[model samples]
Target: MADSTQVFAILAVTLAAFVWGRFRYDLVALAALLASVLLGLVPADAAFLGFGHPAVITVVAVLVLSRGFERSGLVDLIAEQALRVGDRLILQTLVLSGTVLVLSGVMNNVGALALMLPVAIRLAREHDSPPSLLLMPLAFGSLLGGLTTLIGTPPNIIISAYRQDLVGEGFGMFAFFPVGACVALAGLLLIVLAGRYLVPQRAGQASLDAMFDTAHYLVELRVPEGARAVGWSLRDLHQAIEEPVPVLAVVRGEARHPGHTFHGHLRVDDILLVEAGPEEMALLEDKAGLEVGPEPPAEDGDGGGDEAGTVDTEGLQLVEAVVRNDSMMLHRTVGQLRLHNQFGLHLVAVARDGGRLNQRLRDIRFRPGDVLLLQGGEGEIGESLATLGCLPLASRNLSLGQPRMLLVSVAIFAVAVIAMVLDWLPAAVALTGAALASLLAGVLTLREAYQAIDGPVIVLLGAMIPVGQALETSGGAALIADALLALGRDWPVVATLAGLFAIGMLLSNVVNNAAAALLMAPIAASLAEGFGVSPDPFLMAVAVSASSAFLTPIGHQSNTLVMGPGGYRFGDYWKLGLPLSLAVMAVAIPLILIVWPL
Candidate 1:
């Protein structure tokens, strides 16, 4: 009883930490593992072995292969081509969400979602809706797709292993298809029609134009020769104006330094990039002797940009690009890259951590996922960004991607899936081989592959494994199981399955689904034995319930993965998730009863 109490305390604290978000999930999980060991709930020696567990290894491998596939441009090519499907909102939701659903069955759910997310975002913009409208549904689709196959998700794989331990034979690859497919189709239909509306319209740092209010606020002012602004400090110009026009950058002779109202002296031929309206521009021009120069000259399919920053505003255009995880710009300051001198483009602003940066643009280092606002000739900006490994959000073109790398990555992934399904090699071993092949083929760099692994998710999975075993060993799971069974003891067989399913869904929503599954599998088997029925129905109930954790972001990694990109808050999940979970339970219970015959 004391051991059970300690395990419960440990888990309670872990759940609170996961929801708090004050600490990273990985740290919270590691703390739980240490607490379990110190409390003697889990043996010291077995605690760290989860790092090498098949599930952990497979997850990391899946992450690497995901990175490889992303670099290969296979998903991009398909998504680009898929643009022809239709432009209507309903048609787009079906195409993108349906694609994710199918892909999740064939690859890691998070990985499949990763490939589809940007595509969904593009489609959302095309349909004139917020990405929030699409991402949550796509995330849910990934979860539903995982239900259909043994290797589709970790929960299903764990359930299969438990079945084998109990009955000498496990579920085959397609054993889950009947129930899972039914549930998935129903969920997809519901999300297509209703759940999409549940997702809120959140405007975040998805575009640079939005970040700077560029359409109305940005303007260029030049200090022509013999102008009074050439003799006055930029600070003086700021003090003279009634309305504030924030200077974005100063384009000087052959060099552009980030501009500030309090820094540097304006010279003849110097151009100031500022965010202001025509009224504010007239105010600045009247007070500071600045002229609103004509727009820069236009360039045609070439890297020409008005003779190195002196040209009128004809050829220049603003672009928003994201620093990809594999970008060469990672850790390098904009000044170091000499974007103006070397790339012939002006670095107007960068958005980091969902906040706009207007000061110290040059010294600021680039990180993956940083959104950059750039200006130059269209062709030059595209070429320079491609060389820097930056992906332009404004344009979803993949013409610059390597076709050979794409083919090699797909071939390697195919071999890995075949090896896992045929049982020639374990899932971990097969995927590790594929990841290595991806590295050798130059589909992903070693650093990029390492970064691809969601460190917190992997660590959380590793730490939770031992804690889950401790729950069963310490008899805490039995404690909960006995009470729940007592409540449902006299109920009909189907009611018992429903009771177990409800509890599994609730627990999985509060904690990591895999850990929830691991903790409940033994208790589920205990219930099936007491009823003198095949454990298949109960086990299948636990499996589906655990994977159906849609009520919160913490319940599943796929949901968490999209939360930031979709700009969703913690509370936003239940808007769509509650109904979806209810729908799953409605379809799953009858299907389980009919298929397994409790």
Candidate 2:
């Protein structure tokens, strides 16, 4: 009883910290674990054993394999093959959402979403609508798909293992399919047939033509005599700066040929009408000793003689590309890439959500769905794009991924998945083997494999596992179960189940999904004991509700990811999400009772 008080106090402080959001949730969980240990709630010898838990190992391994899937180009291959997906809106939504749903079940749903996001944009282009119209459905579909398998999501994995501890046997890989499969199918159909109508069609992504009264990052600089830029051709000077900044005009005594010119020879005292971000503009002043303020054209020849003949643009061309999920440049800025010095390519302009940027190039972080206007030679730019993992947006076809490696990666992953399903090895062993195989098979590098793991997520699971065990060991779970029983004492058993489901889902939206599952699952077991029924239905309900966080972007990482790319307002989720959450409750309760029995 004293132990219960200590554990309850620690959890309350932990919950408050999470809601405060001053620190990350993982840090909060870790602090709670440490607190529990100090209070003698969790044994010191077993304090760090949560790090070795099967669920943690499986999640880390799954993340590594998800990276392999992304790098292999196979997921992209599927998305590309679905190019002709369908014609009408309903058919298109069905085919696209169904594909994501299936893909989400096998791999990390985020990876699945990343692989398919470009395809969603392409589909929106074909349909002549904003990406918002399609992206929300895709994001929601990815979340729903996670409900159908033990390894499908973190919440499901946690629930399965908790059952394992309770009954001395865990759920099989496909155990969730019996009921969750039905819910997923019904939810997806509603998304296709009815839910889409609620999604607003805001032009939130990749519209480069006159979308707004955008910024004109126009600045001017003058080339000084004896400067490094003097006597060099315009092409040489342009190449010197890399590509984030564009030279709008080369003014020599007002005899400029073209204002938005690509290349020309530089003369001493030449005034450059530069249209570029502040970083590049600063670079021009510092690197080339160019002075501020535009000057009149030079007193020399008109320089209009060559017209299009003098500047050699045969190999060099401007390419427009959109950042993909696997891009190294994701969340990085132009200055970080050193585009001019490293790749001889320059970022001319970047357009996001059909508008220009107001932030300086150095300050603005790159995000997926941004359309970058690049200037460089064909070979150099193409190689750079491949290295950066960006997809060409224009009609030009440039393949940046290695399709040949896809086969090897799939085989490596399949061996592990089969091993797990067939009970040939534990999930952790099989999946850890697959992650190592991915490295040995050359699907991904060791550094990339390490980067693939979400450090915060791993820490959260490790810390929360011990915290949860402490809660159960101290009878806090039973106490909460008694409270829940009191709340529904006069209600029917199914109604009590419904109340638990609502509580779990509401908590999930408020907290992290895995945390919700951990907190609710044991209470659900106690609820089952109180009602004199099997705990399977209650556990299943907890899993379902924990994964049903659809009311807000903050609920799930996937939803938050789509928020920027889809250009959705925070309140936009409920337009479709509210109905979908209701549908889950409407469908999941009956399915759970039928599959597991009350």
The global Cα lDDT (0 to 1) of model 1 is: 0.74
The prediction achieving the highest lDDT against the true structure is 2
> CA lDDT, every prediction?
0.74, 0.75
Q: Where in model 2 is the C-alpha error above 4 Å? A: 1-6, 19-22, 204-405
Clashing pairs in 1: 295-313, 295-314, 296-312, 296-313, 296-314, 296-315, 297-314, 297-315, 298-314, 298-315
- Per-residue lDDT for 438 in model 1? 90
Over the stretch 224-253, how does candidate 2's per-residue lDDT look in tens digits? 877888777655665576544556456678
Weakest lDDT window of 10 consecutive positions for candidate 2: 306-315
Score candidate 2 by lDDT. 0.75
| Candidate 1 lDDT by residue in tens digits, 397-453 | 544269889889889988887886787876667878999999988998997887677
